[model samples]
Target: MSTLSGAPAPPRIPEAVHRRRWAILAVLMFGLLIVVLDNSILNVAVKTIASPEPTGIGATQSELEWAMNSYTLVFAGLLFTAGLFGDRIGRKKVLVFGVAVFGVGSALAAFSGSPGELIAYRAVMGFGGAFVMPATLAVVMDVFERHEQPRAIGIWAGSVGVGMAIGPITGGLLIEHFWWGSIFLINVPVVVVALIAMALLLPDSRDPNPGRMDPLGVMLSIIGLILLVYGIIRGGELANFSAPSVLLPMVGGLVVLVCFVLHEWRTDHPAIDITYFKRPAFAAAVTAIALVFFALTGVTFFSAFYLQSVRGYDALEAGLLILPLAVAQMVVALRARLIVDRFGARSVCTVGMLLVAMVLAAFVMFDVSTPLWVIELVLLMQGVAMALITPPVTVSVMQSLPREKAGSGSAVSNTFRQVGGALGIAVLGSLLSTQYRGAIEGHLSVVPSGARQAAGESIEATLAAAERLGPAGKALIGPANEAFLHAMHLTALVSTGVALIGALVVAVFLPDGDPEPERESAEGAPGRALPVSGR
Candidate 1:
């Protein structure tokens, strides 16, 4: 078969390996589980690892923030390039190598003696994750037939929610029985199992005619994403969106990203095909996925604190309470394809987004006196909404891409989702902080000036101040909790708007029905480029 550029096609997979596609999926899911787990597991472990007393690393608040944000920044920065590289090289090889690297990073992290060391080690884990994440989805797209891809993608999307739900619970359990390092140590064995299975069961696939590497594009993308993520993380931590620390990096990152797009559009060998965004299915699907994550991460961030701080639940209890959300997502995700088939992507995703918006609106009514059952019900509905949206959006995006560009497509989808989540945490957390500070300031006059500064800083600080002051401190607790709740309600209101806007975008832009699959070259060469369908 002759291509436009006349490059030789890549080698075909053996028919024998095709029979074990389901086994391949299991391996992929296991690898995916570990990567996704790391994103959330550390949240529950942070206090234990950062406390000044016994079994802690004596990390400062800033250091604790970095322990989480560093991983995310590095992961998002490297994802696109990693995916494109896997497409050019062998995806299976990259996946195995990534798991091995992640295991090594986890082992090193388990032995970290300081917060700085742990932060560095987490960055290593993020690097490994970038490699593993996109490769898993790309491999799934390769192994599954077009008709069966949606269900497979649904299961894949469900694994992400499952890992997220289980992370905090698993961390809470480990922290109770074992050392603080146990959380990181747990990943080693899991990664080992994933590595072994991946090696044995997965088939290697790559774009045979993949052109020259776009080093400039890679550099720009990495720099832009890192700067953008860094700014967001710093903004949330400092609670000052207008500060130079936040605006400079954020604006610089945005400018560089624009440059990256222009460069990609002009380059003969682009890392990401800019034309993919022109397809309504691809663009709308990515937007929907990003919006879902934006809501998910934002709500989860504050709600975890609300459960433990205001509601007086233990860490383990809080994790358990959130488990229903994960369970609901898994159940609904398994049936997402059927829903999409019956109602179409536009209707299903739009309804899902609106459902999430409605739940966020309900959360605006939350206060210190709100019942636990009400919160639980909201979480359950949010999970169902997420399940409905994520799988179909993912399936649509993957279905729209050519087989050879699957890695790039997966990376783009995942990157946008991660960035959206990061922005949600940053922007919403900042809003919560600002409102909490303003609401509680007037009430702090009863406390001494020396104590007032610490008291007004955060809900935790206020509670601690109240505890130290005895009855007077206790007096402050009620008002402080109320203030925090007010902030949470405001944040929820903002999130509701964001979700509704996402629904509007989907309703307006996304096309209904399953996209027609592009036919392969007549000679069955997988590397040849096919004409994409117009929106």
Candidate 2:
């Protein structure tokens, strides 16, 4: 094979990876797992962190909401900017830096002395997550060939379920044996390993000619998201959407978001391609993913409280009970690609959403008297439904875009999901609070005014107040539990409606078959100008 009068040519590096890709995927998944785990692990530990004791910080319900929302709010706000940043610079570099930053944030969060401090640290972690999240998916898209992409994405999506599964159980064990802070401290070692693996295994990726950063778009998105989320949180906490706290930010955020859309439409170099929404498949996929997260996050938020506060399960027991949901999601997610290939994304996603709607409706049956097995069964069904929907919807969105825009696409997808989650927690959490307070108000007449305000604040507070009252508190316990159950039923009904609406949207709009193959653009990057594919 040697050329005449010349030494043999250097060994060629293959353009496509066939074997090493899987190793790369493993590294990407580890990074994804930690980011996802941080989102849910705190859910199980909320009570422990809020307990007024030597180890607890005595956070109010509003403070607790801030603790969760701060992470998601900042995460959502920074995601698009981070994704663009990674694409312009280097995905692997940004990912590594993100992991390092996340590790530092985790270490600080573990030592937070107050809820406010924890919220600040969580926001820092979220900033790191914004960098890490999109890069992981973008790298997967870069490394894997088109044909193998579905399976790789399925596995990637399944890692989210794995994180969900591990978060609560890990948090529970750590909180039970050590302290609530240990849940965060555990991330440090994991991050160290992830950083080392990512550095060694991941190939660098970036858009060689990515346009200038869109500063206006970044500011608009960040301000819009934070304000909207803050307004929602305030509305829920105050139980008055008409109040200035709710109205001003909510309206202002909406206006700013509309302006952002306009700005993107007019800009030559936009952070996100505003025209992506013109594709029905892309739009439907985004909506489906967002709605699913909305339902899942809200339900998980209340379910944690219900399991521990209402049902009298300890943290470990509650975490174990929630384990079935994650288990079912992980198992089914592994098979989602096959199912989608056999059927279609449209069919699979539609069915999944309907299943989610059905599961939410089933939650109405849950109460203090409901059997543990029944609760587990319902959770399992919800997990299966999410498994079917999430992977297909995500893959569809990824497929709809050109590979060159993978970072931006991943950011948009994740931003919507995180925003939906934040809104879910805010809206549903508010509804629960309002209903619980209303229902429990009459029953709390016997209690002192000072104690009554504390009891009305949250289920956890009510339970804690009752414990202090001892015998008198025993009477308050039954009503408080009943109020919580009532609120759960209301929220479930609302969630059922939301899920069914998502199902309808997917069925009506999402295309029935594979996406059209993308062609290379004038600049040699893949472009999304191909005609839509049909079944």
Candidate 3:
């Protein structure tokens, strides 16, 4: 492998780090578990949070969406900067600091009194997550030699699925037995354990020459994304995209993002290298990640409500229902790389996208009384589809980039994934709200005129109004369930379309084959080392 001219020598790995690589991997996974787990847990807990005061935060549908998007906005925006910090400061230091900050943020979020406060604290958690996520991958490269990285990366990526799948089940147990806040509170102890292990088992590694940090680019990206997502969420809340509030932010966000692109093109020290998108394979792979996550995360957001509110499952039961999804993702992700290694990314991912689209389309058939097994089967297949897509798409992205630019490749991949997810939740959540509000509006006449608008906001709102109406409110229950089912089906159908588009993109543009020579992988990438695989 060729080293860049005048690049400083790579950091030497300590004997102890090599000796305890697996344990070190455990430490890294612990860090990853809490970051991914927090979001998945909230998916289950969102219902409880939407319940009226005393039992829940009494949040509206838009507030609940903000609570999730806030974290993603901050996390996606700061990821590149955090990865750079890890290379400049030391992965161990950044990992430990990020864990501590995340712990404090989780503790704060657990006690939040309102949706607004929860969104704020969640952003703090995102700040910590940005640092922790990249550092962990960088450390994996530090500890493992090139020969073992592929396997190590495969396991690392698999754990991400495990974290995502297990969270709903874990949150179910907690939300059933304890307060809604306990879900967030649970992260504190895990963060403590991870911190202690890092202090002991984690090794320090840094780039001897981590060039020019890009604060301007990071700031612009963050500002632009937040503005754009805010506009989308606001449009949903009003059910009117033509409104000034929606158009203003959406246009402003677009303008800022354009400025960000221009700056990156002009600056010597850009956070993201836009030129990389010139590579057809890299462009297609990242777009697939963006679109797939956009579609899937949106459906996942609505599934929690469909399970608990429409189907009348308890939190625990809902969690158990999603267990098949978790199991499939965890089981299949571990094997996706080997499948890709033999079959190539283009075939596996394109087929995977089509499979994903088919499963999402199945959701169009769900109603208030859809069979439980059918729902489980859909989720199981959804997990398998995602597992097929993530690993190979990740490898293809890296394979297309110059070996020296792999750090940017990894950061850019994660940024797109997070941004895609945030948009999914915003766009899809808004669609559900708009459809439900329309469907339930006539039914809201059962309540006072003043309460009608509120009740029409969501099925939960309608049910809460019905609960206040006592026996008469019983009339709203059937209608509320029907309306919500209508909204969910429409949203799922839209997601299916998005997934199909991703399949077309992958089939047309993604490259074939595994990454280049082991030596040419992310191990020797400039700045902090990028993972050979992905999250």
Candidate 4:
């Protein structure tokens, strides 16, 4: 097949695996749950973590930003290589190992006594998560037949919404009644459950024959992503892209990535088949995923602060406020396929991204006096827009590849989504920080002279400083809230613009009809049950 067509034969799962696939999907979702849950839980707990000791580790805003970015940098860096591992070594083994490591990292993160320790531990969690995320989807690709893959993927994508719903509310409850560490600690039991179920139910599957591993290619990819992401984070930190420290790494990273791509294109047995990305639909699907998550995650990172710090909601209350967003995601995601079938991927995605842009702009109207129901309505709308965007685009990306290349497809999908999120947090979060600092600097006179600079860094810092001053400190609250609102408004506007950019990409590139898969007819070859169904 390689000498002639270069495409592999159709995939055939063991009948046992096929029979147990729905159950196996549940186990995979359990694995995905902890990964999604960790981030969503942090959304609500970040405010508490910024609080002074006894309740939290008293992490500064920058440290908190680092905490999130550290996890993302490592996760994005390793994802493609991890996918290659799944394809070559085994999906089930890699999934189990990843879940186990996630559990260990969770426990370590729960025990971290300082911001630095927590950041390090979170990176460890990312290492495990990098493996878990792609393998689960690859396994889904393995067990399900082509026609049924969309439904399976929809439900699978919807599970992320479920995790989003459960995480915030659960974190809210735990934070209200117990230590903040309890949020991370809760992941331990879920991990244990996922591991056991995986052991019992998951089938070990891999490319029975794979080409040579490209170690140099893997190293180059890791280095390139880390450098690029580091540059993005630094730019956001300083809010300036011209600084030598920022420009150097960013330029170096781009050159390295270009080299890596050229090498893979020329080399036999390249780490990822770079040619697949040359397909328009495949490229658009990846772009849409990356851009949407970029808009969504950046907003998500700051909304917690806006809800709690600016609007005076407690952790539990803020979590509850976010429920509508997740609920809409779950409901709409499950039904997105039917809509796409009628309207086609291009129409649905373009329209969805436009709706997302509108929803983000809707956030601009919210202020101190805005009613809670107004916020909830906008959140619900946001969820529906995202749901419409996620499933079709995901299906497009996965369906483009031959079944044998599912691991790489899944890797391409998740890797960009994570990188988008990483950039979103760094870029948008930095915008919020910078805007708040400028807005509040003149008013920091309410704080002691020594603490004025720190107090103006963020709304949380300003509030914390005010509290330290006792009665005199109470004066800082008004200005802090006002400053954050200004920043939040600007960030939301920018996110709306990003969503529009995504919409434009989808409209210009994705096919008006569903993109046909390359070779799915072989899946049902008369009565043939050949294990090697393809080339």
Global Cα RMSD, each model: 4.3, 5.0, 3.8, 3.4
Against the unseen true structure, what C-alpha lDDT does each candidate score?
Answer: 0.83, 0.84, 0.81, 0.87
Candidate 1: misplaced stretches above 4 Å?
1-13, 46-51, 55-64, 445-451, 470-472, 519-535
Q: Per-residue lDDT tens digits of candidate 1, residues 149-174?
A: 89899999889778878987997888
| lDDT value for model 2 | 0.84
Q: Which residue pairs in candidate 4 have backbone atoms (N, alpha carbon, C) closer than 3 angstroms, thus clashing?
A: 9-534, 9-535, 10-534
Query: Per-residue CA lDDT of candidate 4, range 1-535, in tens?
Result: 2212555544356666777889988988899999999999998999999887888999998888888888898899889888889888888888999999999999999989999999999999999999999999988888887778878888888999999999999999999999999999999999989988988888877776568889989999999988888888887777777889988988888899999999999999898888888888789999999999899888998899989988999999999999999999998998988999898999999999999999989989988889989999999999899899898998898888766666777988998998898889888988888899999998888677988888888888898888889998887888888888999999999999999999999999998775655543433332222232211
**Model 3, span 76-112: residue lDDT tens:** 7777667767766777787888899999999999999
Query: What TM-score would each prediction reach against the true structure?
Result: 0.92, 0.94, 0.91, 0.95
Q: Candidate 2's residue-wise lDDT over 1-535, tens digit each?
A: 2334365532221344434788889999999998878766888888888798566788888888888887887788888888888777878888998889999999999999888899999989988988999999988877776778889999998998899899888888888999778989999999999998887777777776677778999899889877887787778778678999899999999999999999999999897889899888789999988888787678888888888888888777787888989999998998999999999989999999999999999989988889989999999998899999988888888888877677888988998898888778888888888998898888887678977887788888888888888887889888999999999999999998989889999999999888755545653334422111110
After superposing candidate 2, which stretches have Cα over 4 Å from the reference? 1-18, 523-535
Clashing pairs in 2: none
Q: Which stretches of candidate 4 lie over 4 Å from their true place?
A: 1-11, 519-535
Pairs of residues at least 3 apart in sequence or in different chains that clash in candidate 1: 466-473
Regions more than 4 Å wrong, model 3: 1-16, 145-147, 398-407, 516-535
Flag the better candidate by lDDT, 1 or 2: 2
Candidate 4 — what's its lDDT? 0.87
Error (Å) of candidate 1 at residue 374 is 1.7
